[model samples]
Target: MKTLQKITVILTIGLALSILVVFFTTSNAVSSGNETIIRFGHGAAESNERHLAVMKFKELVEEKSEGKMKVQVYPNEQLGSEAEMIESVTFNDLQMVAASAFSQYDQRISVFELPYLFDTYEQAWQVLDGEIGQEVAEPLLEDGLRVVAYFENGFRHVTSNKPIEEPEDLSGLKIRTPEFPLSISTFKAFGSNPTPMAFGELYMALQQGTVDAQENPIANTYASKFNEIQDYLSLTAHQYMPLPVAISEEFWRTLTSEEQEIIKSSASEAAQFHRDILRENEEEMISKLQDAGMTVIEPDRDKFREEADAVYEAYKNRFGEDFVNNILKAVK
Candidate 1:
């Protein structure tokens, strides 16, 4: 009977040890299955559309992945300037980023920055969201980047401390432009001194009179409150700014095929959301700018177009006449 009791005791202890082992193993597996986190960076104020769109992307991506993925956003150059962020993506330091095509012009994405190339937002979207946009993404792929979507930044306008009623009014003025060669050339064509400065430094430069003027979308001007320091706004719409949403190729390749689909789907949905918001808010943005004491001027667009002619002539070889013609055709 004592022998039988010993066998029972031993069996009980063995059962307890087996249960403990399974419990610990299961706990470790659960911990190991936690979601991956992605950091998305951009160079815009929190209140700006670009920042808002990125937030929307985060929401969509997280929701679509059912908590299997997460996104953390860094706005207002907390990560760094646009150029810096792009480099971070290349080095796998940042997982994703959204930046103006102009900021990436030096990276050979300047093909999208040709002045007067896209006449309207729709045409620009068709070209950018379609095959040509995919082509533009090709170069970045070689640099360890993946383009997901293009968000419309809208048409850029000139805001100056002086009243600008015509192309001639731009003469001898120092205007702050993006550090893109094409942008500098565009302002130079109108005889303005183009100063390439980071967007974060622009407000101070204008306030201190370091620059006589700067150009941006009306919404951006209003959102940034640039109208407070500037007296005049010319509705030149000379350039169409588009923000390309990109991810680090290395990070992207690490994901499973299903995971990649989830991210791409979420990004595409967020892109459309941003476009819708811009369309709805455009008129209100213009009204807000006018209310802020900015004298809005409607100059003879043809004259401005005539001045921008030289930009094409100088860049035709680099951008190719056929490419330029394709853009014009898409807009038409």
Candidate 2:
């Protein structure tokens, strides 16, 4: 009878130990299995500021999440073109994309494409980081995308095989531009025959003489090696492009409030890092272009602005004077 009691006690203790082990194992699995993965895509090369911003976001998010989250970045359109990547993000196939062409989704975003919209980068930031940007980005939420932060594409300048001393020089020239309506309007106002084309096709277009000129920030122009194909770099300062860090709203809905806050804060930090790097290298980029045998011309910006008044008038007509007035008011 005593032996039977001992066996019963031993069996009970063994059962308790087994239960404890199972409990601990399950706890550890739950903790580790909750990790989330985010995929980010952009069309720029690895050397571009947009890609660098993605890398920075990845580092910050992983550190903040304590390994609970991971970010995978795809550069040079490995995922797809900008428009296609944006579509994927909207459908939740991709988590994020740094898209310069957000204007395509909402016409209100075209306000950023307005020629000579901001006199200085500081002024531009004041509007973009304030209520104005939020107002502009409000429409994106309806399309299953959210704007986390605004990025700088700097001031766009013209590069062509021929010298552009004035807006008149662009007369009848076949100029390549992004498929943004405001950009086309700006170039058309300057008398160029604006041809909208994909960014990836631009190099071949310039090389084969399909287009006579193209405009982009100095960093992009240098990085894309346009200096080899184009002879002149005209500082048109026609527009200050604003790129947006956008995330999938569907994916956003799946995140906890804390996670969403972490992502937003990280995106803003990465945007500042990107802007600093681009500003620091802008002068060096121009110098490199000059060294590559491209003559740099600082055109009379006032003349260019004066010529683009009609385009601005059209914007006010299309978007309403009050809508246009609100953006201009934010600059002050």
**C-alpha RMSD of each candidate structure in angstroms:** 10.0, 10.1
Segments in model 1 whose C-alpha atoms lie over 4 Å from true places: 1-32, 101-107
Candidate 1 accuracy as lDDT: 0.81
User: Candidate 2 on 1-332: residue-level lDDT in tens?
Assistant: 99999999999999999988866432122233578778888888887878888899999999999989888788999988888899888887788899876766888977987999998888888888889999989999999989999877888999998899899999999999988889999999999899999888999999999999999988889989998899999998899988898998988888899999999999999988888899899999898888889999988999999999999899999888999998988786
Model 1 lDDT tens row, 3-68: 999999999999999988866432122222578778888988888777788899889888888988
Instruction: Please name the candidate that would achieve the greatest TM-score relative to the true structure.
Output: 2
Model 2 per-residue lDDT at 322 = 98
Q: lDDT scores for all predictions? A: 0.81, 0.88
Q: Model 2: clashing residue pairs?
A: none
| Model 2 ranges with Cα > 4 A deviation | 1-32
